[model samples]
Target: MKQLFYFGLAQAKACIFPIIIFLTLAVTKIIDIPFLHRYDLILLVCIITQMLMLALKLETMDELKVIGVFHLIGLALEIYKVHMGSWSYPEEAFTKFLGVPLYSGFMYASVASYMCQAWRRLDLKLVKWPPTWIVMFLSAAIYFNFYTHHFILDFRWLLKLLTIILFYHTFVYFTVRKRTYAKPLSLSFILIGFFIWVAENIATFLGAWSYPNQQRQWEIVHFGKVSSWLLLVIVSFLIVAMLKHLKQTKGNLH
Candidate 1:
């Protein structure tokens, strides 16, 4: 227990800069600034910060491993999506720091940080049924995201589909192999993914973020406005669930 606490403290020390960068961006309205103006520079800064933190080796090796996997997954997906034109950022956000997407690595780091907290607090159990759920949820998510804004479709979809399948299998293999999480966490990711698609679709339909060139007509779904919020809640709960379990376990150990 002491080891875990100390490790966390060390990680925090290592991550101070990246955390500060994110906070500064969030609070300073820099992130919200026009993508054409400063998005690229900001993303470049992010890439640098993450690289530095990763090289520091301040966190647990296990956490880094999971995060590396997530980073690769995010990288692959981002490239595939960009090629497909499913979604894209403005010119300023563009940066191929490592021959792939820049934002993905940042996302990977965040995911790793979140999962590390759970890993410390919980030893997950792997169950067979979760794979089935993963597949189903992914299918629903793809459909939802595509049906919404046509971000994922056409020739690229074939590749995207394959990529999603591969991602799911990889997750299954690692989560099951390491027993880092149980069915609940799997369900959480799947559900959240689906909700994101649905919410994104709703946003497109309502003209929240338009794809002017696509000229795609949205088939009206329901209020749809809440879909994104629903996703956020679910994903947040999943992380919390794992952390809550870990906290309880830590208390018992003490």
Candidate 2:
């Protein structure tokens, strides 16, 4: 019980970025700014918060780079998904390009930030991590399927199956203070994805974005979206893992 209490505290500390974002979302939804549009306000808040986090040394430079990549990757997908009518940013904002508010990317960045922060705080390690080639190949397939599935057949289920097969044997070792713990890598993906899905529900409820059904009336987001988040979480984890490996490799060469 003591270890579990400490574990929760560590997780909360790692979630600082995401917590701030969520609070901003909720607060901005209810409060009105005189001139600034809500979407623009969100964009501004995300930028300033990121800068503050870096200046304070709360987030390392290397992790900032990873967060930046997630931002771009997320924006691209948001642009494409908006074009395809997957969902929308209905609020008006000068920061919007192609109907996606720039802040949307930050929401994705929060996920990467969480993973990176948790990695640092928990002293995470991988056991029996797959070879670089396989990991890279699988990550590419997961991301590609996210795009191609819109046009071609939806291969999400198959990709999910692949994720299970690829990561089932792998384990994540993490320290909650002095007590170390291990769990299947796949299970971590599912857990993070599940929490992201929960966060998504809250975001939508607070008018962050709206689905087709939500546009007409507030409704529960489809449970199927959990699978989508699961796959996305996998892509995020793989990218972080690869970047960490590269950094370590460089450090060793020094």
Candidate 3:
């Protein structure tokens, strides 16, 4: 029970950036900022928050690099997804481009932030991690499938199954206070994906962005999106894991 409390506390700490972003989304939905567009203001808030965290030593430079990579990757994906008519930034903003608000990328960056923070706060390490080639192949497939599925047949479920098989023996070891606990890496992906799905619903409800169906009226996001989030979480985890592996092993990206 005590360990569980500590684990939850660490999780909350890790989620600081995501929580702040959600709050900003909710507040900006109602609050009028006459001086600036809402999306621009959101972009500004995200920038300021990141700078403050850096100055306060709340986030390490390495983590910032990770967040930066995720930001660009996310923004690129967003640009394409919007172009493909997946979803949209319905409101106006000077910072908007290719139909995506600049701040929208931070939504993905926030997930990377949580992963980075949790890795440190929980003293996380991987066990029985897959080989570098297999991991990289899977990561590439999972990421590309996000875009390919829009044009071709959706291979997400098959990819998910492959992910499970590859990482079935893998585990993440994390410390909760003085005690240590281990969880299957695959299960961790599903749980984080679930929570991100919850956050997505909150973001949509707060008017961060609207799905096609929600554009007319607010509605619960489809459960199918959970699969997308699952793959996304896996991608995010793999990126961070590879970085950690490189740093820790000084070469192997396993």
The number of the candidate with the highest TM-score is: 2
Candidate 2: pairs in clash: none
RMSDs, each prediction?
Answer: 11.4, 0.9, 1.8
List the candidate numbers ranked by lDDT, top first.
3, 2, 1
Off by over 4 Å in 1: 1-28, 31-37, 40-58, 97-101, 122-187, 190-254
Tens digits of per-residue lDDT for model 1, 99-149: 343654554355445545433434433333224344445444543453345
lDDT of 3 by residue, 151-242 (tens): 79989999999999999999999998778889899999999999999999999999888889998999999998998999999999999999
User: Each model's C-alpha lDDT?
Assistant: 0.46, 0.92, 0.92
If scored against the real structure, what TM-score would every candidate get?
0.41, 0.98, 0.97
Backbone clash count for every predicted candidate, in the order shown: 3, 0, 0
TM-score of 3: 0.97
Model 2 misses residue 133 by how many Å? 1.5
Q: Compare candidates 1 and 3 on lDDT and give the better one.
A: 3
lDDT, model 1, position 108: 39
Worst 10 residues of 1 by lDDT: 169-178
Instruction: Report the Cα lDDT for residue 249, model 2.
Output: 78
